[model samples]
Target: MRAVFVRPGGGGVEVRDVDVPEIGEGEILVRMRVCGIDGTDLEKAFGRPITPPMLGHEVAGEVVESKTSEFRPGDRVFVHHHVFCGRCYYCLHGSYTMCPLFLKTTIEPCGLAEYFRVPRTNVERGAVLKLPDNVGWEEAAFIEPSACVLRAINRAGFRPGDSVSIVGVGPTGAIFIRLLKSFGASVVAAADLSSFRLEAARRLGADIVVNPLEADFPEECRGATDGRGVDIGVLATPTVKPLQTVLDTIRKGGVLLIFGAPEKGEKAEIDFSKLFLRETNIVTSYSTSEVETNLMLSLIASGRVSLRDLITHRFRLEEAEEAFQTARDAGRSLKVVVEA
Candidate 1:
């Protein structure tokens, strides 16, 4: 088998031959169809590492071997990378992602491989689902990311007719735009340095788009909302500057959803007085739970949302380096996929 490995010391990805993982008693081996490249994969390839050896996570495939009665060979599916123990306190409190068990398990090797294993713990807890017949590999590949975006929107208390300013129009921001519109958000303006991403946001239904280089993003977002500011501001990229500047782009008492995860100890100072006086609330989201994954799959199955358009680049397993390079330059690509 061949898998993409993140080279040590912040270099890039490498495709190497490796022995296929042996499935455990209750596990299933999945034959990869397509795997979606996320920002974290690029981070692992060129920046600091988040997960070990493994990188990619957005996976969709067919069951090649099943040891449990719940699945059979040739069954098409979308496998979640994380599964939480529903019996835990964190799970009981609706913070499923915070459950300790959720963080400990993952597919063997990585999602960016010819094949991988789904553990029994994940299967017993319902972390796997059969892809609908109409859903293509690209759409199934969206299950994880869409589930993540759904979690953020739900936690942020988003409502119909609310206006939102999305800072950093990358793949994640594009998902936010599409979902916010479906949720009935009225004004959706995106701010980014990349014209390629901005155009992608426009296609995804962003009502207005602005480049931070050409204009004041905060001011432009405020202008679209009668000078009061948008109801919500999303810092999608979590760049040091945007972390400090997005606060000025929303209305008093509005919400700021930090969807991007910054590296450990990466700090940015903010105006405490302004934050307190305005009653600005900061909310964050991490990972996806089975709750949103089910809904996301349905959304794609029903054709309520289309993901094929978001995937602008595709590569084979051997083209890992080129794929990571294109993903690094946001000016050229949106969603990059690696096929089996």
Candidate 2:
């Protein structure tokens, strides 16, 4: 089997031949069909790499072997990399993503491999979901990410008909637009440094688009919401430099949701006086849990929302380097997928 590995501290990836993962009792082995590349994957590959390099997680595949009765051979499925222990304090408090076990459980050898093993813990915790017959492979690959978006919405306590301003219009940002529109948002305003992404946001149903580099994003967003600023502001990029700008786009007592993951040691400076006086509420959402993933899968299976159009690039497993570069560049591409 072949798997992709990131070169630490260097913006590069290499494909190496490795033994196919072996399944243990109550475990399962899946043959990769398609996997979606994520911004975090690119960040780890290009920027500072974490202890374990990021490869792929938004994945869909065909089951080749199963040791549990919940699934069987020949089932098309989407596997979540992380699953929480429902008995933990975090889980009991509705913060499932913060469960200690969530970070300990993952698919073996990462999701960018030709084959990977699903651990028994994940299997029993409902981390694997069977794909509907009507769902295509590429669309199935969106399950994990769409689940993430849905979780963010839930964590932000997003209300229908609330005005929104998104700070980044990348792939996840586009998902936010689609989901917000479906939930009956009064208006959706998207902002980005890339004109290409702004246009993509427009096509995805953003009522207003602005380039922070070319114009005043806060002013434009405020104007769009009748000079009261937006009800909620979302920071969808990993970089925290634009965080203040996102805060400025929110009205007093509004929520500022951080949806992207920034590297360790990254810090942002803010005026505590204003943050206190304005009563700006800050919230963040990490990875998704089984609860959100199941809902996202059901939404996809029912054809209520379509995510197939977000896929703008596809690369073979051997073309892992090019795929990483394409996503890192963030030009003329929406979502990039690596197919086995």
Instruction: Give each model a TM-score.
Output: 0.97, 0.97
Q: What is the lDDT of residue 132 in candidate 2?
A: 88
The candidate that wins on lDDT is 2
Q: On residues 1-340, what C-alpha lDDT tens digit does candidate 2 reach at each position?
A: 8899887456688888999988989999999999999888877787764324648999989999999888889999999989999998989998898899988888889899999999999999999999989989999988999899999988888999899899888889989999999888898989998888998999998998999888898998888888999888999997888899999999999999998888777889987899999999999988899998899888988999789899889999989999888877666888999997
lDDT of 1 by residue, 234-257 (tens): 989935568766788889999988
Q: Evaluate all candidate structures by whole-model CA lDDT and list the values in order.
A: 0.87, 0.89
Rate residue 176 of model 2 by lDDT: 95
lDDT of 1: 0.87
Residue pairs with colliding backbones in model 1 are none
The worst-scoring run of ten residues by lDDT in candidate 2 lies at: 45-54
Model 1 earns a TM-score of 0.97
